[model samples]
Every structure is written in structure tokens, then in C-alpha cells.
Target: MSPHPAPDPLAARLRDVRVDFGTRTAVRDVDLDVPAASVTVVAGPNGAGKSTLLEVVAGTRPPTSGTRWAMAAVAFVPQRAAVPDRLPITVRDVVSVGAWGRRGPWRRLDPAARAAVDESMERMEVTDLARKPFFALSGGQRQRTLLAQGLACGADLLLLDEPTTGLDSDSGERIRAVVRAEAQRGAAVVCVSHDPEVLRIADSVVRLVDGRVVDGHLGAGATEPQPA
Candidate 1:
């Protein structure tokens, strides 16, 4: 008999994860596994702890209890609101910051890194805005720039919060395409979104309610791509 093939390794895992803030619990009793080369969408109404759970998976916020494990490199693109307005930084500067993880601070980007930044901006259709100030862009433009930054990171795991929250059909579809491409390239992608279009492209969907998972299953579009 032939030996069984090994199971694909997980990009991240959360076991009984929980988070608390003084009197409130943001997330609790959660267990999730992120497989490589796949997209997992977390969906829920407002205040359902979707963003908080994403932060835990990104390893940016330690859970009040439970365990979280993820790959070494991670790119987290938060909602545009999280970014301060009127920053002096340019769009190119923001995208280049992604490469800093590999090149470190105060160091010039190598030719390959530069190419990645340029390519990322192009992919997000932000090449034209490269010289523009980050704060000067509209909401959709800023979101695209941020996504380009995340793409430039070349991380094994990508985490995004409401990547397509508010945008025109074209911009939203472009982002969705990029997200699917990322998974195809072997990165584990986790997104917090309520967009029906987003849910349609996800391989799996985990729903949350009151800081706990209420449902988890294959997405409706798991076997095929849905029209944008």
C-alpha cells in the first residue's frame, strides 16, 4: 500500500482564544485554523468582535487568555480609520514601509524590494498616486494604497479588516481579485468583511456573535467564483 500524503500545514491557529477589556469581553471561546493557500472570511454584525479576533490572529494584540500561533511573517492591513489623517507621508512611502520588515528601519530597499513596491502599487492601481500624500487621497484611494502596502510585505499570512468596506464597484472588485490571487500564491488570508461579494469568494466563513463563533462552514462560493 502507498503511504498517505502528509496533511497541509496550517498558517495560523487559535485555541480557546479570548480577549477582555476591563468589564467587557471582546472575543472568547474561539478556536480557528487558517490553512495555507486559502481565504477565510470572518463575518458578523457590528461589535461582534470580528476586528478584535483578527488582531489576535495577527499577533498584534495578545489575548487575555488562550493561545494563538501564526507564521513568522504577517501583513496586517487595518481599516483606513485606524490611520491618522494629515500625515506627511507619501503613498510611495507608505507602500515602501511594508518592505521594512525584511530590510529593517533606516535601510534602503534593495533592487528586488523596490521592484516589489512598484509592482504592488501597480497591482493595486495606485501607481499614479505614488507621489501623492497619503492623507490627500479619498477613502477608496487610501484603502488601495494600504492594500498595496500589505502586498509589498511578501508575508506568508495576510490579515485585513474591512478591506472593501466602502468603495465603488470597480475598486471593490479589484481588491477582491487581488485577495484571491494572494491565496493562489500560497498565502493564508483572513479578512473581516460583511460584503456579500467578499463572502461569495471566500473558501470558508466564520460567523461571530457576541464575541463567540456562531457558525463556521464552507462559503456559498467555495466551489466557484461569483459575479462581482
Candidate 2:
């Protein structure tokens, strides 16, 4: 008899994950699995624990209970609002920071790492602004630069929060295209976005309400969301 197909590997998994902020619960009983080569979009209303869930996946914020597993290499890009606008650094400086994971902040990037930074900036259509101060760019440009930074990391898992919240049409489309390319190139991409276009293109959609996952559709290599 033929052997059964091997189960698809997961880039990240959270089983019965929960996060609490003092007296309030930020995320409750969330079970999610992110599969490689696919885009998973987390959709919910304001304060629906979307960002909190992403943090849990990113290994930035520990869950109060349950378990979380992720790839060793991960790149997380926070919303533009969370980033300072007055940093005295150029766009290339910002993108180069993504390589700090491989080489510490004090060390210069190796030739390969440097090439990755250049490629990422070109992919995001921010090559022309590479030498400009990051703070001087417009909202859309800033967002693209941040994405290029994330891309430069060469991480197996990529997480982003509200990547296209407020941007001009051109910038928004560029970001969306890059996101799709990342998944196609074998990265597991998880994003928290309210944009209808983003939601429509996602390989899977997880909907949260009041800190609980109300519904989810599993994508390739992913299992169904467990009951709360």
C-alpha cells in the first residue's frame, strides 16, 4: 500500500494561547498555525486583540498561558505609528538594521547581507530613497522602507501589523505585491490588516472578536483552529 502523505510542516503554532494585561485579557484561547508559502491575515475590529496575537506569534510578547512555537528566524514589523518619526537615520540605515539579527548592531554587514538589503529596498520600490532620512519620507514611503527592512532579515517567518493602514494607492499596491512575493518565495507571512483588499487576497483569514477567535479558514499546510 502507498504511504500516507506527510503532514505539512508549520512555521509557527499557538495552542490555546492567551495574554492578559493586568485586569483585562488581551487574547483568549487562540489556536493558530502558520504555514510556509502562504499569507495569513488576521482580521478584526479595533481592540480585538489582533496586534496582541501577532506579538505572541512574533515571540515578542509572551502569552499568559498556553504554548507558542515559531521558527528560529522571525522578522516582525510594527505599525508606522509605533515607530518614532524623528530617528536620525537614513532609509538604508533602517533596512540594514534587519541584518542585525545575523550580525550585532556594532558590526558591519557582510557582503551577502548588504546585497540582501539592496534587493529588499528594490523590491519595495524604495531604492531611490535609500540615502534619504527615514523621518523625512511620507507615510507611504516610511511604510515601504519598514517592509524592506523586514525583507532584508531573511527570516523564515514574517509578521507585520497594519502594513497598509494609510497609504497612497501606488505605495499600497507595492506593499501588497511584495507581501505576495514573500509568501511565494517560501516564507510564512502573518499580517494584521483591516484593508478589504488585503483580506480578500489572504490565503487564510482569522477573525477575532473580544479577544476570542470567532472564525478562521485554514490555508495550505495549516490545521483547523481549535475550539475555545
Tens-digit per-residue lDDT, 1-228, candidate 2: 112322355788888988999999989999887888889999999999999999999989989998888887899998863446677899999999988887878698999889999999999999999889888988888888888999998998999999998888888888888888888899989999999888766889999999999998854444553332
Off by over 4 Å in 1: 1-8, 81-86, 220-228
Candidate 1 residues 18-51, lDDT tens each? Answer: 8999999999999887888889999999999999
lDDT of 2 at 228: 29
What TM-score would candidate 2 get against the native? 0.90
Task: State in Å the error of residue 100, model 2.
Answer: 2.0
Q: How much is 29 displaced in model 1, in angstroms? A: 0.3
Q: TM-scores across all candidates?
A: 0.92, 0.90
> Model 1 residue 137 lDDT?
91
Off by over 4 Å in 2: 1-8, 81-86, 218-228
Cα displacement (angstroms), candidate 1, residue 41, comes to: 0.3
- Which residue pairs clash within candidate 1? none
Model 2 residue 183 lDDT? 86
